[model samples]
Target: MADLGLFGPGTVTWRVHAEPILFVGGLRSLYLQALHPRAMAGVAQNSHYKNDPWGRLVRTSIYVATAVYGTTAEAQEAGRRLRALHARMRARDPFTGEVFRIDEPDLLRWVHVAEVESFITTARQAGVPLTDAEVDTYYDEQRRVAELAGLDPATVPASAAEVAAYYESMQPELRVTRDSAEALVFLTAPPVPWKLNPAVRLGLELGGPRLLYLGVASTALGLLPTWARRLYGGFGLPIEGFTAGLSARALRTALAALPSRYVQGPIYQGAMARAAAAQT
Candidate 1:
């Protein structure tokens, strides 16, 4: 299997395929079960915008951005920019209204783990051959990221046994569902209203699925010669595929119409006003 060029030699794929799976898998576990509950509670217990639609939107945006981009430096920069935009959209008490950043450590841990787990679980589901040692290496690489994030590496569970134990502790707080499995729903359909810049939203909606399709295609293309891979990259075929998958025109159209149908429209405004009044 290793020699079959499932990820091609000397390419980013080879370096990433193994460890990334673990990272995605762990992230799925943390977010879908662990951090999500706390985030919901924080919204209810601490924020004036308890059950605010905007709040849900913010969380979903973060999740979608993270999934499409992964944790690359480019992705982080994009997240920071989006976060700044989000901050400008509302005014509230910084101390408590920023529920998203409150339990950041847990959130980061969950994201890191879910990302790796996603890769691992997806590969396994797709019938990719992987060994236990490969899984361990994946965990070890993720530990480095955790350490960089100021988390104690020792605190991260090493084995599935340890992870299971941690989940057991967090089970009472989680809202589990079949759709929430692997946290893919967060990426595919964020809990929040899609109010992204039309261009950005269009890009994501179109590019998200395209990227996944291309990623799978790239695995097949890996069977080609190094020269062919270089040619593919040089022509930007792979990058284009990746980008196109994430941006959907249909999504853009739907999002473009949402403000009128759900935000500024009478039905939504009335609902929001009632919600606000009830909170006050």
Candidate 2:
């Protein structure tokens, strides 16, 4: 049972997301998702994102971690919780005056693809050594997570080619809104809580948070598609695709060099313990 989650230690998601480089990928996903006006509107209306940005970030990270590492029952429960939450959320489109549920399939699909794109792009570019086939496999494997998010996995893009087509089709629907623009600024320099180590908290108070945020935002901006970059008005400019890929790879290489005990968080550690016990 411990080994029966949607994805375990052996899956591509575990391999890719378990890495600290996913910090960059997560930020990239936020940047990409904001470009969708409808999605941004839903978030802005329904979430305390402006007031507690880091809280939202942590909650999202926890959801992903739970889905990937928790046991089958735990994973299903997490999905159920999210689906129930979304079912209660509704938002109006400021541009069209059209009201929609936050859990609408199309919006969910957009968020799913954007996140998948960021994760795959960041991992591969950052030197994860995944083959083209493995890349496609990674995309296909993520459909399970998509289903958990209340999307019809059968309708979701399951291959690299399909993902590209999906993005191309979505381009017309994607635009930067004032909400998104403001969110981007907030995301780039969101407040960090003072609950961290005293020294670390003090450092964050004295310009440390901004520097960290800039480094991450820069890396995320680098990973964006050229069209998306154009939309942001060069938030991290002079950083075209090639240079961005290089930066991702360099960051991955450096993070990969860190000790596992220092880098792998509680989720990964718990998954490892579960896997070991299951083997016994």
Candidate 3:
């Protein structure tokens, strides 16, 4: 039988993550992560995301895919690589002028919570049909991922209530910084490539990228929590849930309509095959 990875085929993580709306989750995670000044500082100093934005996105997507779908050995190796990377990376404190490891427990916990919360909320608003219990299960399951990232699972939030408390406790610490502002600008309208800049800038023949940028970016921004949106200059006006839901459902349906070859990459296919093999 093939290795079915950590959650295998039976877990909520499998179902929740398999949806196309996770693309929005990924973007939403970034929008949420950037609001933390310290977290954003780590990225600003240690990551080349600024120079290679798409590459950074692809790498992050690949890591999450591998962690979720890879065989046991594959997942462990990915975790090992992550621990080693985090061990070696350092960031300077923007306010205190102190040096710190990028993998400090508080930092890791913040990033992990931000990511888990972003993915879960995005799934819910995108109409993924997760029950409250399933949502809690998903959060509990994600502790394994936090462990993989060198965080102590015990320190991570393990249920919906815990996650909410964690966020409430974290609210005072969340704020924009110079690093975050720069990242937002880049993420909002990333530099058009030298080759395509003219056409894209002129709106001549290349409108697709611009439209996609606006669509995904706006939807992700709208999907942020009321407090997060407030930090980003939004009034959190009532709530953007209605419009965001419409956008998320639309994106979900459209992506679901894509050919399997386009929607299901090698990681997903190989995992599904291994799952079937194990059953047989």
TM-score winner between 2 and 3, please give it: 3
> How well does candidate 1 score on lDDT at residue 54?
51
Residue 26, model 1: lDDT of 31
What CA RMSD would you report for each candidate?
A: 19.2, 2.3, 1.8
Q: Write the per-residue lDDT of candidate 2 for residues 79-164, one digit (tens) a residue.
A: 99999999999999979899999999999999999998899988888888898888898999999999999988899999999999
TM-score of model number 3: 0.95
lDDT of 3 by residue, 1-280 (tens): 6888887889999998898789888888888899888889999999888678878888888889999999888888999999999999988889999999999999999999989888988889888898999999999999999999998899999999999999999999989898888877778777665565575666833578677878888888888888998998888974586688789888988888998898787898899999988888
User: What's the CA RMSD of model 1 in angstroms?
Assistant: 19.2
Least well predicted 10-residue stretch by lDDT in candidate 1: 1-10
Best prediction by TM-score? 3
Candidate 1 ranges beyond 4 A from true positions: 1-35, 40-104, 176-280
**Backbone atom clashes (below 3 Å) for every candidate:** 43, 0, 0
- In terms of lDDT, the best-performing candidate is 3
Report the number of backbone clashes for model 3: 0
